[model samples]
Target: MTTPYPRVELGDLPEIDVFSEEFRAAPWEVTSRIHSPNGLARSSRGIEGLTYQSAHTVLGDRRPRIGFDEMYQATGFDESSPVYQAAVTSINNLEGDVHKVLRETLGRYFTRDFVQTLRPVVRSIAEEILDGFVPGEPVDIATRLVGKIPSRLFASLVGAPLGDAEFLEKTSDALLTVFYMDNANHEVVEKAYAGLAAYVEDLIRVRQSSPGDDVVSYLLDVERSGRITRHDVIVNVTALLRASTDTTAGQMGLVIAELAERPDVWERCHSEPGIIPAAVMEAVRWRTGAWSILRVVREDMNILGTPVPAGTDFFGLAVAAHRDPEAYPDPHTFRLDRRRPKPTLNWGMGVHYCLGKPIAQVEMEEVVRLLTERWTGVHLAKPLVTDGEPVNSRPLTALIGHTPR
Candidate 1:
C-alpha cells in the first residue's frame, strides 16, 4: 500500500535556516545537505517534524496527516469569514471520510480518459497563445506566453465564459497570494477570495438554469442528489479552479526557461517530439514545483531510529527528496533521459496526490512541444529569477527571451 522510500541512518544534520536570505536565494544547497543519507534536519520556524529529503521515506509512509486546516487556522481565519469557511470545507482542506467522499466524487472528472478528452481543447488554447508570440522579437515567456494559458484553459474547463477568463485569471492570482506572499493581509486576500467566490456563486446559479457538460453543471447534479451541500460545491469548485491554475502556470514557465537555457535539450525535443513527454517528466522532477508538504504525526514512531513523538509537526522536504542523490543518481544534474522507473513526488504522494496532475502534465507537455516546434531558436534574454522560499516561489519570472524560429 505504500511506496518504498530510501532509508537513512541517524546522523548529524545541521539546523536549516529556511527563512534566511541565503536559503531563499539557493534552497537546493540546504535541502541537499538536509537529505544526506545519514542525517535529518529541522527548520528554524519552531516546526517540530522529521525532514525526509529522500523519496522512499516520505512517499512510502502514509501514516502522516496533511496539516492544511491547522495551517489555515494559524492564519487567523476562523469559520466566521466566508473565505475561511470556504477554504476549511474545501476538498484541499477536508480530512477523513469527508475528504474521501469528495475526492471520489470528483476523481472521475480528472481520470486519464476524461483528461484525454480535453487534448484538442488544451492544444487549441496553446496554439492560440503561441499565435501571439513573434518569432524574432523578445517576449516575456513567463508572462505573455506561459502565464495566461493555464488560467484561460481553467476558466474554459470550469465553464467560465470566454469574456470572463481574464477576470477570473486576475482574481485567481490575487486570491492565491494568501498562500505564498509574506505581505498578504487578511483584508486583501479575503477580498480577492470573496470576489472569486461570488463570481463562482453567480456561475453556479447560471448553470442551475442552463446546465452544460462542464464541471459546474456536474457538481450541480451532485448537489441535487443530496450527496453534498451547496457550500461544498462552491468551495470545492473554488479549490479545483485554484488547483488547476497557478502551479501549472508557474511550472510551465520553469519548463520553458529550462528549454531556453538548454538549447541542446530543446533541439532534441524539436527533432523528436516523443522525447518531449519524458523531458517534461524530468523537468517536473528537476523543477521541484511543490517543494514541501506538512504532516502531523498520529502517534509516536521511530524515524531513522530517532524518536518522533505524537503530535509532532513533520515537514516533508520534497524539493530535497527530488534532489536526493540516494534516490536519484547525480540528483542535481538535468538530463532528459533520467530514469523515472518509479513515480516522483513532485506533484505529491499518497491519498493527497494532486488530482489535477493529468491536466498539469498535458498543459506542460503541450506548451513545451509547441514552443520547440514553432520557436526553434529560444534563449533567455534576461536573468531567470525566483522569490526567496520554495513555497509560493514564483517560477522563473522575468524570463524575457528571444525566440527566432
Candidate 2:
C-alpha cells in the first residue's frame, strides 16, 4: 500500500528543531531554511505544515483520523506515564463517535449564550486585578494582570473558590508542558496531572450536593443521567481546568507584552475600543503562544505532496503558518483591520478544534477591552522573557506600566 515517493522523514530535513531556541525566536526564518518545494518543514519533531493551506489541511483533515493520543505515543508516552494514563480516555484523545459524544456533551456548557453570561464576570475579575496596581507605578503585569485573569476565570466558571487560582496557575503550566515533547517529562507534570485530578474530584463532589449554573454542576447532572461517567466528569473537568488556564494566560500576557512594545498599536486600541477584537486577532497571529497543533495519522498520507508514513507526528505549525506571506500580507507587522481568507489558526481547526475557544476568546477580548479602559497606553517596564518554544511559549517575565486613564 505504498508508492515510491521516498518517504520523507522530517528529521532528515536538516537544521530545524521546531522546539529549539532558534525555532522559538524565529520560526519563520528556521522554517524557511528548509527549502522543500512540497511545503514540508525539516523539523525533527515531525512533518510541518508551514504554509496556511497545508496547515489548515493537516489540522482539519479527518480522513486519516488525526489525533493527539497517537502523537503522544509517538513521543513515547505510554500508560506507565501518569499524564498519559489520565488523558488517554479524556476527550482530547478520543475520536469518532466517542469523541463526538463527549464533545457534544461538553458543548452545551460553552454555548455563545453561556460565554456571554460570563463577560460581566470577566470584567469584574479584570477590574479587581487592575485595581491592585498603583497609578504611575510599574507592575509585574505578567503575574499580576495577564496571568491572573484566565486562571481566576477558570475557578469562577467551575464554581471553585477564587483562592484555588494559585493552584490552577501552578499546575496549569506544569500541565501545559504536555504539548511540548521535550518538557513533557518534567517531574511537575505527573504531580500536576495527579493533583488536578484530586482537586477536580473534590470539586465534583461539592457540585453534586450544591449543584449550580457551572460547568462542574452541569457535568454532574449529565453523570446522573447516564450520559457520561463520573470519571468522565472528573477527568474532563480537570482537562478543562488544564485547557483554560495557561494558553489563555500566555496569549494575554503576550498581547500585553507585545502591545507594551508597540505603543502605536496600544494607543489606537485604547482610543478605539471597537478595534480590540481585531487587535486580538492580529496579535494572536503575530506571536501566538500556541505554536503548533500536534496530530497523527493511522495510515500513510500525502501532505502537500510530501509523503508522511503511518503513525508519524504531523504538526500544523501555527507559529510559522500564521506568518506565511501568502496567507497574510506584511505578515510580520502587527496591524489590525487587515482582511484574511480564513480565521486565525491559533485556536486550531476541524472536529478537534478547541472546545474552550469561545471562553478563551471572550476572556481575551474582555481583557483587551479592560486594559484599554484603564490605560491610555502601555509600555514595558522591562524586557519580556519567554520559554521561546514554539508550543506553549510562556512569558517568564513581563513588567509593565499603564498610563493613567
Candidate 3:
C-alpha cells in the first residue's frame, strides 16, 4: 500500500521531533506544517516510529498496541524489578482476554452510576480545599486547587487513609516521570515505584483483612475467585491511582484557566450548570492532557498509503488530532456549541479507551460548577504558561485571583 501523498523522510523534516525544544515551544505550528500534504509521516528517528496527526484515520485502528512490555524491555529495566512488573503487567499493558477480564472486574467501580455515588465525596473535598483559599487573594490554583482534587479523590476511592493522599500524589508524579521524561533517572523512578508498590500492598492487606465498599475490596473478591493474584491487585490499584492523579489535575488547570480568561464562557457555565459537561468536553478537545499514545505495530500495514513495518513504534498524537481542521471547525478556538462529528480522541479510541473517563468528566464538571458558584470571577494573575519536555508537558505556574460573587 502507498499513501496518496508523497512519503516525507525524517531527514527532510528535523523540526518534527517531539522532544526538540523548537517543537515543544510550538508543537501546533510544527504539526500543522508537517501534516499539510499527508496525515501520516515516518520519523527518521532511530526508534522506527510513525507520527500520526489526523483523527479521521488514526482512531479505532487496533493494529497499533501500547506495547508496555516492549517499552519496558527496550529501556533495559530488570525484569524482576517492581517497576518493570508494574509497567509490563498493568491492565494498561494487557491485551486479549486478560485485558477484558481485568477491565470487566474493575468496571463495577468506574461506571457512571458508581462514580455518581462519589459526588458527595468529591464535593466535600472541593469545599474543604476552597474554604482554605481566601476571596480576592491570588493563589496558584494550578497547585492548590486543581492538583489536590484528583489526588484526594483517588485516595478516597481506593480507601487509602485520609491523610495519605498527598504522599500518594507525590509518588505518582515521580512514577510518571519515568515514562514522560526523556532523561529521567532510572534509580529515582524505581525507588518511587517501589514505594508505591509497598503502599498498595499494605492497602490490599488491610482490605483483605477488613473488607470495605471500595476498589481494593472489589479486587480482593476477584482474587478470592483465583482468577487474579494479590500482585494483580497491587498493579491494578496503582494503575488507577496513577491515571487518575496528575493527568486529571493537568486537565483541570487548563479548564479553569480558560474559563478565567473568557468571562463569557465562565458566566455561561456559572448560570447554566447543565452546560458544564459540554464545556468539559471542549476543554479536553482544546487542551488535552494526554498528548500522545505510544503504540507498536504488530504486522506490516499501510497507514493512509504509507507503508509501515512490523515492530515499528508509532506516536498517535492526540494534540495534533484534536487540532485537525477536518475534524473540528475553527479547531483552535474553544467552543461549547461545537458538535463533534467524529468522537474526540482525548480519552482514546477503540478497546484501549480510558476507563476513568466517566469519573474524570464528573470531577471536571464539579470543579467548574463549584468554582463558579463560589467565585464571581476567576482571573489569572499572570498569563498561564505551558512548558515542559515532550514526556511531561503541563502548565508551569499561574496565580489565579478570585473575587466572591
Give the number of the best model, judged by TM-score. Answer: 2
Candidates in order have lDDT scores of 0.70, 0.77, 0.74
Reference-based lDDT, residue 70, model 2: 52
Best by lDDT: 2
Give me the runs in candidate 1 sitting further than 4 Å from their true place. Answer: 1-13, 34-39, 46-63, 181-183, 298-304, 309-312
RMSD of each: 3.3, 3.0, 2.9
Please tell me which model should have the higher TM-score, number 1 or number 3.
3
What would the per-residue lDDT of candidate 3 be over residues 49-166, giving only the tens digit for each residue? 2233343344457767777766555555768866788887888878888888888888866777898987778888998999998778999988888888888998888888769988
Output the lDDT of residue 261, model 2: 75
Greater-TM-score candidate between 1 and 2: 2
Model 1 Cα displacement at 319 (Å)?
1.6
What C-alpha lDDT does candidate 3 achieve relative to the native structure? 0.74
**lDDT tens digits by residue: candidate 2, 291-355:** 87777767877665555678777778888888888888887777776975367787888887888
Give per-candidate clash totals: 4, 0, 2
